[model samples]
Target: MTNILVVNSSALGPHSVSKALVDNTVEKLKLSHPDANIVIRDVGANPIPHLTADNVVPEPETDAQKAARSLSDELIGEVQVADIVVLGAPMYNFGIPSTLKAWFDHLLRAGVTFRYTEAGPEGLLKGKRAIVVLSRGGFYSEGPLQVLDAQEPHLRALLGFVGITDVTYVRAEKLAISPEERESSIAHATTEVEAVVNQVSAAA
Candidate 1:
């Protein structure tokens, strides 16, 4: 049975385009693999605390630090057990949201998710697939605005650092441009999502 973990980090909550895409994707995955175990972590709704010196250092600390550590363990445990990870990452100010960044910070643990070797730092979590659903106000997949967009590339790099190299992206862009453009973008993204679902189903 496949274990899927869905992580949402859109401040827009129920009205978020990224969340909608992720929801569609998850529903398709369920259709394909009815026995799959799916878990959700809504970072935007319940934001994880940012990493502090106390939490990182791993020593005797206050109650807050202990709570943070426990949460980190739960977050990492979920990733470790998941066969596939789905992320709803919306661009904010040309970058990723702070809520997602905080979750990433907690997962970056030495001698756990990654470790420094003689050559360089090597990721320990391997053989995992990731699907990132991105929603952007402007076109950033290509053209002049691409350089200014840090959301996709940063997520790719960070996920790859944790050994999740098998990654796919479904993007809904040109939002906030016009109602027609938003509709077109969403329609295109929905098609892409269907294609992704077909591919994953075939693989299964």
Candidate 2:
């Protein structure tokens, strides 16, 4: 059986294009692997508290820190146990949402998710694949605006840092270009979800 972990980080809730993309992606995965167990972390609806002085892991192990650390442990465990990870990210001001960033901050732990060695730093969580669906308001997939698009690159680096290097990207761009373009991008992403599921089946 496959273990799939999904993260939805768009604040728009019902009206989110990214959430729609994520739902489609999960449905495709289900069709491919009927026995797969899915765990969803909806950070948009319940945002993880940003790491602060109070929540940072402490040697003394304060009550607040303990609760924060436990949540981090749970988040890291989800990624470690999953065979596939599907996440939806909507661009905000040329970058990713702060809520999503907070989730990453909690999951990334030294000697837990990653480690340092003689060769160099290495990620601990291996043998995992990530499918990221990104929604952008402007033309950021390619062209002059690509450089300004910080969402995908940041996500890629973070995923790689945790040993999820087999990453695939599905982009919904030019959402704000026009109403017709928004609908077109969504229709295109829906097709992408099906393609991704067939293109990469469960590794057995």
Candidate 3:
């Protein structure tokens, strides 16, 4: 059976546009993959600890800290078992949330998710697809606000680091511009989600 890992990192909880988009995407996936085993990791409500000096100090940790470190290991293991990874990543100060970044730090382990090769670096986890659902308050796909978009590019680079080159981004921007625009943006994204679902279903 195909396995999927869903990571939700919207600080706004159920009210978040990014989270809603992710949920819709999952629904679409289920329509195609009826037997899909999906695992959801909600990093917003229960965030993993940031990698502090104590955690990465190259020294042994206390028992309690060691237990906390185990959480990161488990999350990385989940990625290894997944065939697809879906992320709900919203723009925070033109960047990704700290929680999502922490998840990446845990998964990007040497000799595990990646390896240092003579040619440079090679990813260990292959044949995985990632879909990032991005929601931004303003339009950033072009013009002046474009440079401020750190969400999509950062995710591409980091996920690609782990050998996930089959990646797609569904961006819902200008959500806060006005009520009409917000509704229209969401509807458009929903159509895109449906199209992707049809494609995946046909391929399946």
By summed lDDT, the worst window of 10 consecutive residues in model 1 runs over 52-61
Candidate 2 lDDT, 1-204, residue by residue in tens? 899999999999999999989998898888878899999999999998888876564552788877877788899899999999999999999889999999999888889999989998898889887899999889887789889988999998898888889988999988999999999988998898878878767453
Clashing pairs in 1: none
Q: What is the lDDT, from 0 to 100, of the residue 174 in candidate 3? A: 88
Q: RMSD in angstroms, all models? A: 1.2, 1.3, 1.7
Top-lDDT structure, candidate number: 1
Off by over 4 Å in 3: 57-61
lDDT for each of the candidates? 0.91, 0.89, 0.86
What's the TM for model 2?
0.95
- Judging by TM-score against the true structure, name the best candidate: 1
Q: Rank the candidates by TM-score, best first.
A: 1, 2, 3
- The alpha-carbon lDDT assigned to residue 202 of candidate 1 equals 89
Error of 1 at 151 (Å): 0.6
**Candidate 3, lDDT over the whole model:** 0.86
Candidate 2 segments whose C-alpha is farther than 4 A from its true place:
58-60, 202-204
Per-residue lDDT of model 1, residues 51-147, tens digit only: 8766875664788778878889999999999998999999999989999999999998888999899999888889987889999999998899999
Tell me how many residue pairs clash in candidate 1: 0
lDDT ranking, high to low: 1, 2, 3
